[model samples]
Target chain A: MSTGGHKGATAAGRLSVLVGALSVPAFVGLWELIARSRIVNAVLFPPPSTVAVAVLDWIQSGQFFGDLSASLFRVTVGFLIGTAGGIMLGVLTGRFRLVSSLLSPLFHILRPIPPIAFVPIVILWFGLSETGKLFLVVWGVFFTVWLATHIGVQKVDRGLVRAALMLGTPRRQMLSEIILLGALPYIVVGLRTAVSISFYTLVAAELAGAFAGIVYRIEIAQQNMQTGQVMGGLAALGLLSFVADRSFAAIAERAVWWR
Target chain B: MVAMMHNPLRPTPPLRLVDAPPEPSSTAPEAIIRVENLSIVFDVPRGEVIAVDRVSLAVMPGEFVSLVGPSGCGKSTLLNAMAGLERPFEGEVIVAGKPMLAPRPDIGMVFQQPHLFPWKSVRRNIAHGPRALGKSKTEALRIADDLIEMIGLTKFASAYPHTLSGGMQQRVAIARALANQPRELLMDEPFGALDAQTRAVMQDNLLELRDRINATIVFVTHDIDEAILLSDRVLIMSAGPGRILRDLSVGLPRPRSSAILTDPAYLALKRDCLDLIRTEGRKAFEQMEAVT
Candidate 1:
């Protein structure tokens, strides 16, 4: 009886795997049929074939590479700068009450205000340049990483700190090694959240004003009423952010090496 | 030290044991740790609570002393004072003729939990102490390798703390403490978290380790048998504004093992300790009852 149940369970598992594999293809096929059938206006909601053709044409066009690199550069450089600043400040505020008292209140107020809300002020401050776009992405990523590291540092095991103190761990080593490494798990978690936030803010940044980017191309395509190109741009953005999040997750797993 | 009297309300056991001996006076070598009238107070929400009340004791160089008491008796608090991890509300703890205001490299401590660095391997964890004290990487790692071998964890030297068993992790903690070659080792129930079998093995390991290291050791535990088994002197403490009740000396010969747990002399000493602790435990219980 148990063997029969086990066999049935394996069969169900295999069926679920097959179903999952077909899920996206099935949805696309249905959307294609519905669009061609005129259930929806094809111009507004282009069929999968049209979108695929537009994406292929985009790759063939020399402008695609420029757009892709521009978007990638802003995200990568902005993420790195924001992450660095966040971790440095997080360690300071987390370790020192004086530093925390001076900065935490200000950060709390600024953190809740959406980064996109700063678009008008950022343009005024830095104009419609790369700096403003970078600032928006950095603003979005910084608070998340900072809060995670701050909480992580505070939550470090008291027992470990006491043990380190007993071992005569010098003050500097205590902060760099024990305190920092102890809080790394939390920091990594914050960093992962920041990855997605960086992409979200990129949308706002590129929408505000950009010479070249995936979102910029989408806006240009919308102006020309090229629905297929617009849909293709959206897909590209989704795929990029999805890849970023997954790759970061893999990196994060290794970051907390002990775990 | 105050001696405990047998309870007249209950019939006495057949064991005929000598009363606790008087505290040893100052002799040739000066004490390595001298806790003078130390008291620690903690502020709770309602009011302040006295954890240790005017506790004074001295541990001689190379002496193995155990502070035995019930839970919340402040024996650990007193031990923390010696480690400079706790501040005295009044008086002070002097180690090596200097008041202990902060933890010094020359003094080491092992806590109930292993508290090993989860990110570091056994070797790196042990090396942390030496490296923190400004030793070069090579010298620190060499010290770590030696201590790892001493702790019989050479096979698992590169294993992280979370990967090891509780007993193995604690062995690494001990090695880490010894990495600095501290003049004084303070252990707050180092084996209390282990199972009975593991704890027994650790006690034997500690006994063997003690003979080789020349450091003065101060151990804290609530287990009477454990206290008597490992210590040259066992100081019994009473709870409720914790105070020392008796100081008993174990005159058992060295090169001892779990085999001594059955010896007649050992049994007699154990009985006396149990009797005193049982009475004190009752008094503490009654006092708590009255408070509520």
Candidate 2:
């Protein structure tokens, strides 16, 4: 009797797995059928087949690579520069009273203002230039990484510091090794959050004005009323960001290596 | 290895005991660690509270001393003052004839928790002190290897602290402190966190380790057996506003082991310590009642 019940449960589990695997494909198949059935406007609500064709066309146009590289460059370079500045300043402000007193209030005040809100000022400063877009992304990523690093440094175990002091660790090595590694777990958490923030700010940046970028192409496709291309662009953006986040998570897991 | 077979993770065997050091003559005039009327104060919201109250003691070189007291008796604060980890509100702490304003490389301390760097392996953790003192990587690792062999953790030298048991981690911590080869070692209840069985083993291990090293040691613990078994002299301290109540010399024979616990002379010394602590504890209790 128990074996019968166990077999029944296993069958149910396998069925659920099968259904889950078909979920996305089933949704696409239904959409394709409905679009061809002429129940709704196919031009505006393009089917999966139309979307796929549009994506293929985009790849063939050679502009896809340009747009992808532009977008990738902005996010990577901006994230790197912003994260570096944030961690450096975070260590300074987090570790030293004088630096914290001088910068913390200003950072706290600015951090709450959304990166999107900087669009107008960014436009005024560097009209239609790549610098303006890069500025927006860096601005979005900087505060988050800075705040994380700052809090991480502050929350480092006081016992570890005391032990290091008793061990006669020099002031420089204390900060670079003991304090940095002690607070690394927290910093990695902050960096992961900034990865998403970088993408969020990228939207505002390209939409603000850009010659080439995935979001810029989305805006252009929208203007031309090519809904299939616009949907294709959206799909590409989602996949790119998802990959970035997952890869970052893997790196973070290794970052705290001891764990 | 034979005794530890019950636990597969514990590959360490009982270490071979080293010959005990020749007893230092009591008449040695110069003290290695001197606390002259030292007092340490902490500020609570209510007001200032004294932790160490005008305590004075002198430890001659190569002596093994224990500070015995109940919990919160400021024994650790007193030890910290000697280590230069705490500031004195009055009087002075002098080590090796130099006034201790800051922690010097010549003095080492082991806290209750191992506080090993989680990222570093046991070898690296032990090497940290020497590395911090500006020793090269190879030289530091050489020192760590020797200490690892001495502590009987050669199998787990590359293991991180988390992988090791409480006793093993504490052993690593001791080796780390000894890496710098300090002139004096201050330990604040180093084995207090271990289990009874592990604590016994650690106490025996420390006794053997002490026999080989020449550093003067000042250990703080609330365990009476631990104090009597380990110290050449035990200084008993009173509760709150901590003061040394009595100083009893442990006259047990050298090359001692847990076997000494049953000796009539050891029991007599322990009884005297218990009597002093019991009377002081009752007085402290009454004093609390009177204040309330």
Candidate 3:
């Protein structure tokens, strides 16, 4: 058994390494073929080397870091405010029939209006500044979170609610214990969706108005015909988005461990 | 009213059983919970559903009574109305001699599921009512600790609901109900979700705890054997739009056990209950089959 286990573990490790090695070679080989065959222009698609060098230069000069930090800050603040408000709204609407009737239709109507549509309006109201960026991010986050909360409330186990009532929970405790606990997994998922939207909306808002942002940098690169730099900036956004998503998922795994 | 008997549980002076009156209602301290011609109708998409018919029942200040019926027979609805969790279309639920309009302070209900708060520890879950109803933090903790010990979950007091087994979660729920020190306890199949071994253990624990607390109890169950073992009198209910069909005294000796189920008299009583319930249960099954 011990020998078999040892062989199995070593085989699994080798298989993972083999897969990783194959992926890199495959990607580079495809890129080389595309560039040499001229199926896509090297100037338009750019070689991976050129894109890597451009990203390295941007990072060394601290411009990429600054833009990344700014974007992160905006999304964080917007996410917190939107999630808090949306959760409050969700609980009230979910718990009370009257409240749901009063607020649900309004939210349903507003939720579908894309944050991009609000770009021009927000910029006009808050000015073409950080305030405008934040407005879009928060709006995107709010709708995602609100929807999750509503669904969460709807799906809570009726039996659990009955049990809490039997266990002598009063009105406020009943809400805090049963309603919020049941809604948590839904809220977490909602927050994750909102976080993704936050980044998407943040990029759009920045590209529309800002002089200093990841999106603005990409736009500048495109205007100057530096396809490599533009591709590098886009790659940076993708990597950052991947990292943010993983962090949220990691925290959520620990937070709602039961689910 | 079967026999006018005071709670033999209290530390009173020695008295003969013969000296006591026979009408149970007369000397039951005061009615801790009283239900008067309670009826309920639920608004469904198709039409109104008559969940309960005119049902009248009363629980003495410290006696234990079990309401037994087939599933969908509205025993749960009766208990819910008594707990002030549901509104009866007609009739009154009087708790501690006061008409219940909403969930009252002196009543606790245990639902079919544990309904424990996963976010909080077992101790904190038990403290929910006391903390909500204005008990100071220290006082609530103290009471919750006592309840945990009483419910035999002292070791799991600090454990979260997710960490505990189903039976343990249910135990936490019982402790939570007891923490408020309610005069009346309303339990709706508190052990239904437990396995057979755990269910029997829970029954013993509950009976032992009930003996100590001396609170008025209105327990609802589908199991006749359980009703016979735990209650002073077992109320057998009929099918849909349910009404009380029989109120038979549980003359089984105190500190009952699973072994009592094998006795001839217990079997006879069980057969009587089954005879009534089987007919009602069959009708309910036929009605359900018709729908589907």
DockQ of each: 0.71, 0.65, 0.28
lDDT of each: 0.91, 0.90, 0.83
Query: To one decimal place, how large is model 3's interface RMSD in Å?
Result: 3.0
What is the per-residue lDDT of model 3 for residues A17-83, given as tens digits with 9 covering 90 to 100?
A: 8998899779977886787677887898888888889999999998988888887788889888888
Q: Spell out the clash pairs found in candidate 3.
A: A166-B109, A166-B110, B3-B22, B3-B23, B3-B24, B4-B23, B4-B24
> Residue A205 in candidate 2 has what lDDT?
94
Per-residue alpha-carbon lDDT of candidate 1 for residues B45-114, written as tens digits (9 for 90 to 100): 9999999998878888999999998888999999998999998788778888778888888999999999
- Model 1, A114-174: lDDT tens digits are 9999999998998889999999999999999999989999999999999999998989888
Instruction: Please identify model 1 stretches exceeding 4 Å from their true place.
Output: A1-5, B1-29
Candidate 2: clashing pairs of residues: B1-B13
Give me the displacement of residue A176 in model 2, in angstroms.
Answer: 0.8
State the local distance difference test value for candidate 2. Answer: 0.90
Which candidate should be chosen as best, given DockQ against the real structure?
1
- Model 3 docking tier (incorrect/acceptable/medium/high): acceptable
Over the stretch B1-292, how does candidate 3's per-residue lDDT look in tens digits?
1121344554654567666532323334456677766788999999998888878777767889999999889999888888888887887776766667677657887877887777778898888788877889999999999888877788887888888898888888877887878888889998988899999998888888888887889999998888988899899999997899999888888888788989898999999999999998898898989989
Q: Each prediction's TM-score against the native?
A: 0.93, 0.92, 0.87
Please state the Cα-based DockQ of model 2 relative to the true two-chain complex.
0.65
Number of the top lDDT candidate: 1
The residue-level lDDT of candidate 3 at A250 comes to 91
